[model samples]
Target: MNEQLIHSKITSMEIDVLRAVKQRTLEKFTEGPSVERARLFFLLLPYFDGKHWSGEIEASAKTVSIVYAALHAHDQVKENASATKKQQLTVLAGDFYSGIYYQMLANLNNITMIQRLATAIIKVSEKKASFHDGLDRTTAELDRSVQQIETELLATFYNFYGFDHYTPLATLMLSYIRYKDELECLQGGSETRIIRSLNETLQHPLHTERWLLEKLDNLHDQISLTINSYNFNYDLKNFMLHQITPHQHRAEQLTREG
Candidate 1:
């Protein structure tokens, strides 16, 4: 099948995912369902490239993206103990998304991917917890954990369908995107677990910024190499490259005479 057909199938599944996870309270309080098109495109890339594709496979892929959105919503939850109602619902949003993914997979009878993704989530959570543990972690270890958190769910889906070719590029690109956001949070004077852990190790926020810049540069190089390893067409490769990395941030403007 062609790319358009693959994308259509994935989109249909995504609609179902949103329907499955819809809740009155969540719809009212938390941010609405975040069915990111970029992630859906990547999830369906293997199918789009003329690999072994099926309705069940597409369904599983949609669930995988939902899992990502779920975890991403939780990541937005403030570390503040005095979280407001919206923030509390944001925490439940992740858990609710997790339930939707589980139920969708069960309906598909693809128990194997469910197990695999669950295991991947466990590892991701453990790595996230490590950052909260008051221990200094080396830059390399921190990078690895961030990577696993960024790509493990998608990688689990890919690996299940023998589509491991995209894991390296996805891992590099996703992790780079994550660190970019963290850098913005740091500049905005907010705290992230990774940034907090990095501050502990580096002993200053400036050092944290330096470390993130170096990490983003290195990930860009790695992403370039990993993309070359894939047998994707020029258009597909160009789309992923232009859209994913090397991601650039817009310059901030300030009124000096104010």
Candidate 2:
């Protein structure tokens, strides 16, 4: 599929996921969901490739997206002394989305997927908690945790439906997108948990930034090679290059100007 079609499909799935989990009070008070476009693109990638897509599969995909949003909401909670209203509601929002995902899967009689995803969530939460528990991790250990934090859910979904072929590319691309944003946050001095943890792990913010930039470059090369290794068409490859993984946001900016 072309990028336009892929984007439209993802937007529609996103709207459905949002509506399924929407609550008026949460919408009025909280920072809504953090559904990233990159995750959605990977969730819909098998379908975009004209694979074994059905309404049930699409519903399952949406549930995975909701699960991502749910976990992402809780990750926003700071480590210490945050009793703010937003913090309180953010906790509830995460729980609420978790429940919605369970119920959605139950409705489809997908108890197996629910079980698998629950396991994935457990692994993810353990890695997330490792940060706060003050476990002294080396840079390599931290990188492993970050990969699970970013790709476990999507990998579970793909593995469930024989779409596991895309796992490597999806993991690399999504992790790249995350570090890209983390680099921006470092430059902006935002001090997210990932940044703070990485700074401590790397012993300096500048080292963390350099590590991130190097990882992004390495992942870009891996993604380029992996995408070509697949039998995807030119349009899909173009979308992966220009839309999914590029040299940097600078490449995207120059493309727009040209």
Candidate 3:
């Protein structure tokens, strides 16, 4: 959120991590370079809360965001049989980011957060794998996986800093964001593992659309309920609701028409 502060912290550590991961061979072979901002904000949340902030903590957080970028990069991989250069790099991106996170934590002797984040990654991976598993999951089961994938890393960081108060709000909002994107994908005729699973489960794209609409409605209700449960101040809550999950009248119209 604070660009100067986060950029100052992120630029210093990101440069070092990039330097360490640099292999003249790999650099030449790679497709793109850099991290992302949404992830940076979640990583810096504890710092914003005035937690036990430090260079080591900030560096660790960057690696965590890098890890998310890695996974996210891979999630872009096409289901096509012929993988492109970008898709190939995506697979390595997640692996490379993971190695950097481990190395950074190891250098700092922050073995505990390493273990915590590793466990979080395992949960995230399993949930991600569920979408590709061809398993017949109910809407509840699918929703649970989505929640874990969105919140596991942030939840680990929150639990580490005794900032568990943010978990409920983060979980709700992130899940909302994810489902919102999923709905857009549905409307655009794009295929995602979740959309495919829903299609298979529902037996038609129309049913998939209905399923997604209902799912989003439920997630929005949950978000509202969970946000109210948090002790966050008015401004923070307003920012999340208005900025993050601003109500889309068009989306409501589509849902109603469906």
Considering every candidate listed, which one attains the maximal lDDT?
Answer: 2
TM-score of 3: 0.80
User: Candidate 2: where is the Cα deviation over 4 Å?
Assistant: 249-258
Total clashing pairs for each candidate: 0, 0, 0
Q: Judged by lDDT relative to the true structure, which candidate is superior, 1 or 3?
A: 1
Give the alpha carbon lDDT tens digit for every residue of 50-70 in model 1: 689888887888788888878
Tens-place lDDT per residue, model 2, 51-77, is 979999899999999999999998888
lDDT of each: 0.80, 0.88, 0.73
TM-scores, one per candidate: 0.86, 0.93, 0.80
Winner by TM-score: 2
Question: lDDT (0-100) at residue 232 of candidate 1?
Answer: 80
Candidate 3 lDDT for residue 45:
61
How do the candidates rank by TM-score, highest first? 2, 1, 3
Question: Of the candidates numbered 1 and 2, which has the greater TM-score value?
Answer: 2
Judged by lDDT against the true structure, how good is candidate 3?
A: 0.73
Model 3 C-alpha lDDT per residue in residues 133-229, reported as the tens digit of each score: 8779987788899989988988898787677887877787787778788889989988788888777778898888777667667767777888787
